[model samples]
Target: MTHTFEPEANKPGTQAGPIPEAAQETLPVVYQDEHLVVINKPTGLLVHRSPIDRHETRFAVQLLRDQLGQHVYPVHRLDKPTSGLLVFALNGDVARALSEKFNDKTIKKQYLALCRGYMPSQRLDYALSVKLDRIADKHKQQDKAAQPAITDFTTLATCELPYAVDRYPVSRYSLVLCEPHTGRKHQIRRHLKHAGHPIIGDAKHGKSVHNRFFANTFQADHLLLSAVGLDFSHPVTGTRLTLNCAAAPKFIQAIKRIDWQEPDWAVAIAPKWLAHG
Candidate 1:
């Protein structure tokens, strides 16, 4: 089964009038087919409704559903502040099959992150206890064993800025490509933090001095992490599918301001995708 990209407003016999509030927001469609749809979700948009952000009026799921005029099932999630490729299954059976692939660790995911300090290519094998939310995980167990988590990181580029954001007179940062073998919550951010190179805008696991410096200097306020690529087999057809997208505009602008070049692989994936606003 194959599906084409057609918004509800463009459908036949649909009356045109004042657009509803939900239709106002549009998520960038990266890839769409009969069984799955991928979107380059913007930063600060939740995958779905959550108690953590009760006041957020808009979400990716809601907006995408409104745009497609059909229900979408999210197979995975990105943090509220992280932006990049997000996949959604169009139906329940496909959603379950994709979820199983994710559960079995068959899906290969790649992320780009701007982190504090220069980092080297390395594989981090760590164990992380569940980071439960007070309101959201209220009914969950208080104590759980740490789960095994592993991530492979490669330093794409590095830059040193002449500013005293922290104790050092010159602050250094790196453009990192992260591939996590496990899907633990906040795994990349936490692993990078553990390695002493937390992502630039990670308020929970990063340094405030650098975060503030970037915000004040470059006006980049969102997390520097982006889910840039995903490689997996099509749930319906056994063919492999590779989906890639560029980071948010703010993220690209920050890289430009810092004079850091994106990796060749990232550029090759989407040449014009890095065109910053």
Candidate 2:
């Protein structure tokens, strides 16, 4: 789905406007120099075009391109529902170098997820090596086209909502730090689903009952995934670089619903080994 670049918003020097309220001046620049640019991307924005979403005209790539007035090539993708630090390169050399970090798994990316059930106080160990069952609809199961996926999650805090379920008491919530060893489409979502504790507001892998509760209670309409931190080598300087972005507003709002404080782990928790690598 290719959206035509429309230079509509006129700000004297720049073109493109009537910016959506969500797309207002919230693009926080974490790090930017001659080589690369990294910023906290807002959720509900597409990174690029795909066969699925054709009407999406305003994307991270296009928005940044217009903001910078030069081509900013995307180095990685954050699912439309996921928001956090996203990297882009100003030139092909930087793009290639940064791509290598991701391809070799040298870059460490960490996310904060709010799950439906109580995540074990102890570290949750699980491997999601499930076959990719690509079906036309999510309700039906297709043949297993397996892929190796692994996720490590640790519970930061847990709480019970005031609302009640059918027979059970109030529902539970867990704030978890997720480290994805592999970047598959919806890997974290699926892994948490396989673990029997899907992330809240996950339309594809989560339960509708919990989603409705979050929306009605917390006003959350998107998935609860935030790319809280990332570490990689500077493409231009070849020096170790680390950047972190705060959890999205919706994430903060949801946490308020459970009456919990953001823990120290909510800060960047990538492995120390990546700094040496």
Candidate 3:
């Protein structure tokens, strides 16, 4: 069954009218089956409720559950500001199985990110300390050491704008395709930042000047990172499934404004696993 939901307004914390064109549209369902369903979650929508974003009314889980008229179990999540493919299991058993696949590194995830500097193709083998939330992980141990985090990335496209968003006369950027071998929280963003090519629109780790430039120039105000693809064996069917979707409209518009050609993997669905193979 096809499902849709009205996205949250562009301006956060307000639910009234005058929603942006993208916000007014329905949530795009990428793939679905008897055991599972996946949706192209728009930027700004929470995967579920949390104390961190207590004021937000709209959530992907609630919307998807209401739209599908069944309880859906979220196997994984995307950051609230990150947009694209999200998976949900129809039953608890499948959820556990899929969760195990993610825990065991059996499932592959591909992400597209627009970063501030031109990044080269490389593998980042860095470790990241656990980022605990004040409200959520307050009771947990705080002195845990950094865990291993690795990401394989390629610079798919690059462009230089004439405007000096930073100290340089010309602002440089790259479109990156990243496959994370480990699911560390914010692994791709942190790894890219460590490489000195932080993804645009990353508030915590990116340069504010370049972020403001994109917001004013292209009207793209959200994070430029998106989970574009997920490849895994279906929990019940035991068949390989490669699910893909394009980035959010604002993200694509920013890429076009920079005159970078969108790679086929960015917009087209792949029939087989193509990253980190």
Candidate 4:
């Protein structure tokens, strides 16, 4: 493995701003500088095109590049159904530096999710098979061994909704904070499923009954997963930067149904980024 990291210097006279609520309809800039630009990617938007979905024309890479009037290099990828902070480098050198950080597991990320069943706080230790693509990895080993994957989960709250979502009359759920130790494709979602508490609205690895329940009841057509916070050293400045973004409105509505103290949850446990807003 190579370990070369050097970020490009920023040019003066260019200004970047955070994503405002009004701009949520489009790609919202969470943080931006001359070297790097971060966006709050909405659910259902691909980070880039993949053989998994060949028909997608509007992707984060294309949308952000056009939105900013410049080319952007994607440092990492978030699943199309996942929403949260996405980082893009204005240039290639910076992109390489940031990508190295992600590979080395130096970039800290926290995700918020609603799960199907009541789960206590626990560390999920498991491995996942690499999800191969139809076109890209067609020749790769179809029966390749599983790769190491781990995730830490803490239950922030739990509740029983008055709806028959499963075999039971009342549906059970938990709001969990998921921190993945690896960046394997669909790591968090897959790990949670292996632990028998799949994320709500995860159509592929989740329970279809609960997914339909959320869709019909809450109008939640996408995964109820959000990258709520990220902490990493800036590629250019080397400053430790912490950023956080709230989940989609429908997620909050589901949380409210659990009777979790939303305001207390924010003030006591949320990062300063959300508090500052």
Candidate 5:
């Protein structure tokens, strides 16, 4: 995780996304204690500033720090366009402890996504090339072999739109549950694209025609990918913890437009642990 303490030199929070400055307090907290703070991050907000997106000024770390009036350490990252549960540590020690869990693959994560075309319940065990940011990893990174990536997916619902999309008379979509076995940058989005069912509203690794259709019809300009649930054992107490976050409003809106029934995996309006964070 990267953070700049140069508050006087630059004001990150002052620059804004579509989310109003007043709505910053409304950011949902999913889990919290002396050691950890987990939040339901909104779409288009960066996990932290990156050289890849120099113009982006709104970030989760900055918002949370200002909201809590203290320093919070990022334990893991959720892509800027992806929303849902994100965890942060209260201090460096806790951050290291939690980061170890993520590195070891002991942390289990589940994501909900809306995709184009039909996808059956199957495990996608595919290899993906390294996706580098033009600014961040441009010349410093080595050209390595494709990494192994696996995502277990189950189709929860399907929709066939009346309008002709591309070649087909009717557009097909699916509500997919994704559990990625490996953590790579854009793993889920790229894997879904490779499987021929790229996520809806994904400007990257997705079909532009389908993306424009969602923007025109459903008013969804953000990617339809959400981290719905996370499970891990606490580093201090060693107790098993299960944290779930509800999907973004636009995601729910898009699913509803397709008449998708809420599957068991979809989280509720409020999970029990929300108030604590």
Candidate 6:
């Protein structure tokens, strides 16, 4: 959670995490319209810049701004290390509308994650409030308990790596679908860790042994979680709007290496983090 990075006066982007000099156009636009825009954000690129990443220029907000040639506002943010669906508002009116929905827990979000160890067979509905690890706060801002965060998770598939993973015999991992009822900084990552199934490739809370294995074998270095789906009532149209995005290529590739299968929703109703904030 702690980084030794120092602030740079010349380059704001560089003070944050690694930022590409040029804006990334490769982010896929999953859904777009006059009021809202959705994109499949890439891993390793920040949604916005922080003090530590001040020198970096590559960010979701900036890229979308340049691509549209107008100002767009972010309704919510995803972790820089996580890739998946992201939503934006085209104007302040839309921003306020969407923001209200999110604050009221009317917006529904789903994420895909690969985590170490086995998850409970039953569905999980938990509330979490994270106290930001001061170490992650490069700006040295006021710190307090994060907003009340709630996340629900269901295990889709569980697989054990065939190869030996250090001292553990064939590390067990799960493909879980997460639905977050509340948005908090690093909510998914912190909640998964709290469940004792820290996400794979999450250097912050994940085991170093597992991270080394993935890095050595797959050359993957970011967290194995993605926000794949979101649903909410359109602020302007007053109609139901649902959006879904696919897992990033690297995450898909990693999951493909393991034996996996999807579960049938034959019955049951659906129910519904971090030190390095």
TM-score on alpha carbons, each prediction: 0.90, 0.79, 0.86, 0.85, 0.85, 0.80
After superposing candidate 4 on the true structure, give the runs of residues whose Cα lies further than 4 Å from its correct spot: 1-25, 139-143, 261-277
Candidate 4 lDDT by residue in tens digits, 96-193:
99999999999889898988788778988788888998787898889879898889998876767788777788888888889998999999899888
RMSD of every candidate to native, in Å, equals 3.6, 8.0, 6.7, 6.8, 7.2, 9.7
Better of 4 and 6 by lDDT: 4
Candidate 3 has an lDDT of: 0.81
As a whole number from 0 to 100, the lDDT of residue 116 in candidate 4 is 79
Candidate ranking under TM-score, highest first, comes to 1, 3, 5, 4, 6, 2
Better of 2 and 3 by lDDT: 3
* Candidates, ranked, lDDT: 1, 3, 5, 4, 6, 2
Q: Give the per-residue lDDT of model 2 (tens digit) for 42-96.
A: 8887887754676677688877776766788898899888988899999998899
lDDT of each: 0.84, 0.71, 0.81, 0.78, 0.79, 0.72
**For model 5, how does the per-residue alpha-carbon lDDT over 169-263 read when each residue is reduced to its tens digit?**
98989988899989988999998888899999889799999988988899888899988888889888887888877677787777666654445
Clashing pairs in 4: 19-29
Candidate 5 C-alpha error for residue 48, in Å: 0.7
Clashes of 1: 0
Model 5, TM vs. native: 0.85
lDDT of 1 by residue, 1-277 (tens): 2222222332211226877866776777867778988888889999999999999988988888877878899999999999988889999999999999999999999898989998988999999989999999999998999999999998888888889889988899998889999999999999999999999999999989999998899889879898888888899988888777777788888876666545443553344436445
The model with the greatest TM-score is: 1
Model 4, position 189, has a per-residue lDDT of: 91
